[model samples]
Structures are given as structure tokens and as C-alpha cells.
Target: MYSNLDRPPLNVTELRRGLDPFFSQLDVVAETGSTNADLLARAADAEADRSVLVAEFQTSGRGRHQRTWVSPAQAQVALSVLVRLPGIAPADLGWLPLLTGVAVADAVRSVAKVPAELKWPNDVLVEGRKLCGILAEVGTTGKNPTVVVGIGLNVSLTEDELPVPEATSLVLAGAEVSDRTTLVRSLLRDFASRFTAWESAGWATSELADVYRERCATIGAQVRAELPGGDRIEGTATDVDANGRLIIDGRAVSAGDVTHLRPLE
Candidate 1:
């Protein structure tokens, strides 16, 4: 499936070689409707644990709250992973996305040699502009639940190509944009290591809460949360709870569109 990619196939080959020690299997696709969509389909047909799907371009990429994620070929890293955690209740699945955000933030800081912070819910920011995004979808079979974690990172996009004015790429943020292969490998390695630790501890929320708080940019700032019920709550971003919900002014918000508000100088 990866043979016909617009970029050289050796990039993925190199990535696979680097990640050989960490992951059991990796699947690279040249083009797809969406990496998350493909992995979910594959997971439903055959339960493959720790499987990865990466695409150079996504024809129908998705974002949080059903937003569209569009990126040009060789400009971004679009990937998804299929994870199976046993004995984990459905109610506790919110941590998956938060955990993934922490992973991505760590990877970007380590690889790009620049600081990156996470916005509540699952957005990575550099210089207060979005550099990456994560979407986690949990689906349950008869007995097992599958979590497909999808990540999209802007690597080397021009200002005109950015979907939103608030978005920025690694290069734009004054960080060196490495090859796609290196970026993907580094991200997978960090995620796999963190996820292993998280699962082994039975999805301990306290362990991740500290790391998330340290790397979060929204905490202690005034922000606006666009709630699902068509109401907006503007408050100080306080903390993230054990369930990974963002605490705004002492209120636990599980789901909402968070917009960081300008602070008064």
C-alpha cells in the first residue's frame, strides 16, 4: 500500500527500521480516506493490537468535533494507532486523548529542539499557535474496546496553505523541520513507551496528570469553552482532573471547544 507514495518510499523504510525495536507491526499507506478510518475498519475485521497506520495524504482527514483536517502531500504527518486495553471501563477512556497529547508534546520538544505546550483536550502549541492535533475514538466490540488515536502535525507548510490563521508549522515556529520519517519514528517511539507505562499502571490518571499540567499552556489562563449545548463558558483554565477533563474555574469540563482568551496585561 505504501509503494506509490509521492515521496520516496525509503522514508518509511527508514522509519520502520528505527521503530523496529518498539512496535511489532507497522503499515504505511500512500493515500487513504483517513488513517483512523482505515485502522478502525481493520480493527473491526481482525483485532490487531498495537497496529499502526500512516498516510502521506488523507483524502478525508478528520479533526476534533468532526472538523476537517486537510494537508498537502509531504507537508504533514498523518498517522493512527490501534490500541486495545483490557479491563478498562468505557467511562475512563478520556485519558487516552490526554495521554496522547502529552506524548505528542514530548516528542515535538525532543525532536524539534523547541518547547511545545498542550492545550486542553488535545492540541499542541508552539509559540501559542497550533502545531499538532490529536483525535481519539473509542469503539467497543463484544468484549474488547479499541481506541484509535490519530495525530496530524504541521511540519513545513507555507502560510498560505495553512487552513487557519492560528495554525503554524514547526519551521514557522523557528524549529527545524526534519524529514517525515524521523518525525513519525520519534512520535511513535515516545507514544509507545508512554502508553506502555500508562497501561501497565492500569491507566493511572494521577501519573499523567502531573506531566500534563507541566506541559499545558491553557492552565491558569482565561479561556472560552464552546459547549455542545450552544452555550459558552468563559473562565480561568484551572486544571485537568483524574478523568482527563479540563477544570475551568473549578468546574470539570469533559467536552467543549476551548479557545484561549487574551489575558489582560
Candidate 2:
């Protein structure tokens, strides 16, 4: 059993009482391999729609590009939310992660009082240090499609506890509050509200795209996109197109690992 005096367990009862009506189901576990994996398996069930799973610790948490995400027990908010979208087109699904990034940045900004910005493709950064990582996976149940969006936010982790030198926790970033429960609740509520609005508008990209661009720090920054198959593109990040692809030097890139290039002296 993982125990930390500074980091207490989440209050599942309070979470359910406050968030149950908004989500199909709300659950919190002491430890799990990955909330995304667990929710993806549950997505096979029809009732898994809008399910929310928050784990106090994720043994094998994963980030984008098959990267491992690890944090000390009770030191972060490891959450995954499952939503089924039967009416949305497959081509437009790329916006899901971008939308999630917007919600996460907004939540962190509101609760943590930190200036959180989006690195292209959904990594949340505070003062150029990563504070959260988001991963969105797609699945199918019957004819409808399911999306499990996982978010791992650093909460109370000290500098030594960080998995990477470039990562920052809320406490380390001087957040006004680093309570995991509050942060998780705020993140879910914001995501649900934004997602519900977008879905109601037939998954439109106009509003979401505008908001994402404004909050994205990568836009207009010099970047080097390391694409799959060992190809790379280095140029300025101009904008995020209607399809949510990063526009690099007028080229729209759909998939790649992007690095912000520092200016020369």
C-alpha cells in the first residue's frame, strides 16, 4: 500500500456526490496500471459512456507516443474520462485532444493560479515546464466510437519526485492549492462543460480552435517536429488549422513530436 502523509487519498464519496450527475459514473481507485487502459476496457460496455476514473497512483501510466508516465503515489491527479460519440465523424476526432488541452489549461489556470499554456498536441506547460500530459485513445463499441482521454497532472510532487527534469508539479509551480480532489473535480467539470458544448454544436471547431490557438504557446514559436519514420521538419509554428493539425511554416502536420526551438544568441 502506498502512503504519504503530505498527500492524502481522494474523497470518493464527495466526488461522486458532486460529479455523479454530470458523468455516467465516477470512480476512484487506490492504484491501477493505467486509468486509460482500464477505461478503454470498460468502453466495451454500453454504459461506459461519460465514465470518469481517477486513480491515486498509476503503475504503468502512459503518455503520447508510448512514453511512460510515472509519479509518486498520491502526488498527482491521474484521471481518464470515457465518452462515446456516435454522431461525430472520424476525421474530426483529432480535435478531442486539443479540446481536452484547452479545458486542462483553463482548469489549471483557474485552480492553480498559474499561467498554463498548451504545447502543441496537448501537453500543458507552466512557465515552459510541463505540468500535465494528456493522451486520447479511440475505441469502438458496436457501431458507435469511444474516446478515452487520460490526463496526468502533477499536484504535490517535489522537484526530486518529478519523473523528468522538464516537468513541474502544482506545488513546485507555486499553485494556490495543490489538493488533488479539487484539481480533479475542476478538471472533469471543465472538460465536461466544454465537451458538452462542442458536441451540442455538432462538434464544431470554430470556437474550440480559436480558444486553443489563443492558449497555445507553440503558435508563432520556432519548432522542430520530429515526425514518424525518422523524418523531421523545423520551422515556425504558425497556427492550428481547422482540422487541429499544427501549421508549421505553412505545412499542416497531423502527427509528430514537437520541440520548441530556442532562439539563437
Candidate 3:
């Protein structure tokens, strides 16, 4: 029962109208195969860093674990932003996904007017149903390297458009506003602020950590983590370590698919 509604073309002029200091360039395309891959290929370009590429519709979008992500055409906020951290300690690169998660939660709460929280590394959930997915990829190695962070959010999709039973859209969450443009602006605004603070502090600050813990829905939850190489563990998620890894039962999980268990478990 999906409607004939397609997202209106992103207003490139309005997006670039004032121009925030964090981003030097912003390009909105009518559509693309994959914003992450597209930006990754261009990461070496001088203008690629501090630049943004937003696709109105992603033909080949993906999520964690190479899971296919599908949404109604133009009915989501699908964009990738590039950043270069020059002289940044490589150890701190793990925080980009968490940082992006925090910013996405902030934007979702502010724009959608819903109670949104982060699911560990980078999933945004409202009432336990996923609303957004974020993927952070590192590209190139040098004094300054690029990390492209991409976020895909379901904005106005109807129930029939959901790609998974566990997924929900902003509209389904009773969001007060489902305008893609507004959500994009708010997300970029919040991300820019957090990113600037993180960069200014040389990635040694704890503000992002503190804020992430406060907004993280996974911490303190009994969970099961499916790690790479066919390893699995179940325990209560204690805290996010300094390296941004999920600490569970004295083990640090760098990458995994976490499933939150019920309270009685």
C-alpha cells in the first residue's frame, strides 16, 4: 500500500545557501549507485575532503555486514561525507562511527521529535526498531587520511516499503516531521558541531564518549554479539572502551552484529 509519493529533489541551492564552515563543498545528485563507494573513489582528490555527496536515491546502498539496504526512491536521507584527519592518532579512528551515531541520534531526536537512541556502534533505533544505519570507511594512508561516513535514514516510507520486519520509518515512529530536507540539515548541523569539537581536541577528549554512553541503548543491556570468523558471545554490555569497542564479559569486540536480549534474560 505504498503511495505515489517520491521525495522531492534535494534543494542543492538551499543546502549550500549559507554554507557551514565544516563543509567546503556539497553536491546533491538526483541518484547514484553508492555514495560511499563513489566518495571512496574520489577520496584522494584535493576537493574530496571536507566535501559532501548526497544521493537522492542509492541504487546499491548497503549496511553493516554487507546487508542490502532498500528504501522507497528518494524517501530517505542517503548521503556520504568525507573528512581528513591530518596528524591524528590512528588509534582514535575507531570513534568515527560512534561519533556519527551520536550525531544521527541528535538529529533524529531534534528533527523527528522522537526518542531515538544508538545501538552500539552505529544503528539508530526508536522504541527498539531500527530507523537509521551508518557506515564509516577509511580510505588512503598518509599524514592526512580520509574517512567517509555515510548514513541512510528512512524518512517517509510506508509500512509496505520497509525492507525488514525489524525496520521502521520516521513516519511509523510518530515523528512530528518527516521532511527529508529538514532531517538532512539537522543531521549535518549536529555532525559538524560534534566533528569540529572532536577534531579540535585531537581525538583525546571524552565529551563524545560521555555523550555516546548517555545516548547508547546497548550499554547495560544483556546482548549477544556475533563476531567475525564465526565467534559468538552473550553477556551484558558494560561500557564502550576508549577505543570505541564494545566491552562484554571482559572481552573487547571490535566488530560484530549485536542483538539485545530481553530484560528477563
Candidate 4:
């Protein structure tokens, strides 16, 4: 069992003290169902873009395809940011996952001193084991047309505490530093800058593609993409296009869960 004895609860006062200069809103709750769900529901009244919502515990946190993500209390970082990308075409919104993935990989590597690679579209991995999962959702019904990007990072969980066999944590990955506050703050800063540049270009450039490609582990791997409707595609992942779709065997797969497969002997 992973004891959170050494991990202190996140102090909003301390977070605001360090993050206020760059962020307009930084909130942390003792517990919640999901930060993304909370922020999505509150987006209409949100003060501005980049407003962050973090929860120490989630009763029903979810990932892509509605998979539940339950982490040990205080042993991980569950956070979501409300980014308002008004007027950006819905078609280009697919980039949100890749965008956030790049930010996470960069920030984690910088702070934790552990090499992190992005598994196309979202998952963040360290040494081929998942260290983080990202979920991006766009509000389609309300007047607030904002994107909620949620990240769940395993920080201090022990091997016994891991929810799945393929998952990892910063502590398990041998991170030189494993402070959640510092890592979250750094991620916000990196995401903000990357988003600023991408937004200013009116979603018309590949300014982020090059960097995402460099950090993506799926680009040159043999993979299996399990598509919706019980169909699957197996091929070499060649690249991710400007719209963030995985190009496998000359097919642009916009939505699917890709599994990396071992190369044949």
C-alpha cells in the first residue's frame, strides 16, 4: 500500500502565491467527481481561459471512452483546465489532445528529470509504461464553447497501488523530483505558452506538430488501433497529421485506441 504520509494536501494559498502571476484562476478542491466535469458545467460563468480546477480526490474520474481512473488519494495529480478556443473550427479541435500531451511530456521531463514520451493522441509514458492519461472534451450544449483538458498523473503511488499492470508513477519511474505542485505549475506555464502561440496562428500552422512528433513514441512503432464498431487496424504508425490524426499505413485514423505491439522476430 502507498501511504501518503509524506505528501501534504495541496495548499491553495501556496499555489496561488506561486501561480497567480501567470494564471487568473487556480482552484483546488478536497474532493470532486471530476475536474473536467466540474469545469465544463461551470464554463459559462468562468472568468477566463486557462482557469484550472484540481481535485485531491475524484469519486468518478473518467478518461477517453469513459474508462474510470481511480487513483489513491493524494498520491496523484488530477487536474483540468478550461481553455476557450472560440471561433476555432471544430475540425481542428482534435489537436487539443496532442497539444496537451506535448505540454505534459515537456513539463514532466523538465521537473521530474525523467524522459517522458507521448503515446499518440494522449497517453504520457515513461519507459514505455503509462505515467499519465489525458482527456479532452468540448462543451457542445451550453453557451460556453470551451475545451476542458484533463490530466491524471501518477506521482507517488507504489507498485501495489497501481490500478493496472501497465501503469507507472513518477516515484516508480525513478523521477529525480516528484513534487506535484511544482509539476502542475510547470505544466500550466508550458501549456499556456504553447497554446498562446498556437491560438495566435489561428490554428493554421504546424508549429506544434514538429515538437509533438519528436516527443511521440508511436510514430515509428508497429501498432494496433482498435477502432470503434469492433474493427481494428494493424500497421506502422508513420506520422500524425496537422489535424492530429494518426497516419497508419496511409490511413488517417481520427479516433481509436492505439496499442503498441512487439516487432516480429
TM-score for all predictions?
A: 0.93, 0.97, 0.95, 0.94
Pick the winner on TM-score between candidates 1 and 4. Answer: 4
Computed on alpha carbons, the lDDT of every model, listed in order, comes to 0.83, 0.90, 0.87, 0.87
lDDT of 3 by residue, 1-265 (tens): 2234555766777788745788888888877888999989988886668778888878899897788887767788999998998887788887988899999999988878999999998899999999999998897778887899899998888888889888888988999988777787888999999999998888774888989999999999999999999999999899998888999988899899999998774
Put down candidate 2 lDDT per residue, 25-139, tens digits, no spaces.
Answer: 8888888999999999887787778998899889999998889999888999999999987788788888998999999999999988989999998999998999999999997
Model 2 poorest ten-residue lDDT run: 13-22
Candidate no. 1 TM-score = 0.93
Off by over 4 Å in 2: 141-143
lDDT of 4 by residue, 21-54 (tens): 5457889988899999998887676565778999
Off by more than 4 A, model 4: 1-3, 20-22, 46-48, 140-144
What shift in Å separates residue 91 of candidate 4 from its native position after superposition? Answer: 0.8
The 10 consecutive residues of candidate 3 with the worst lDDT sum are 1-10
RMSD of each: 2.5, 1.2, 2.1, 2.2
* lDDT at position 263, candidate 3: 74
Candidate 2 steric clashes: 0
Residue 157 shift from truth in candidate 4, angstroms: 0.9
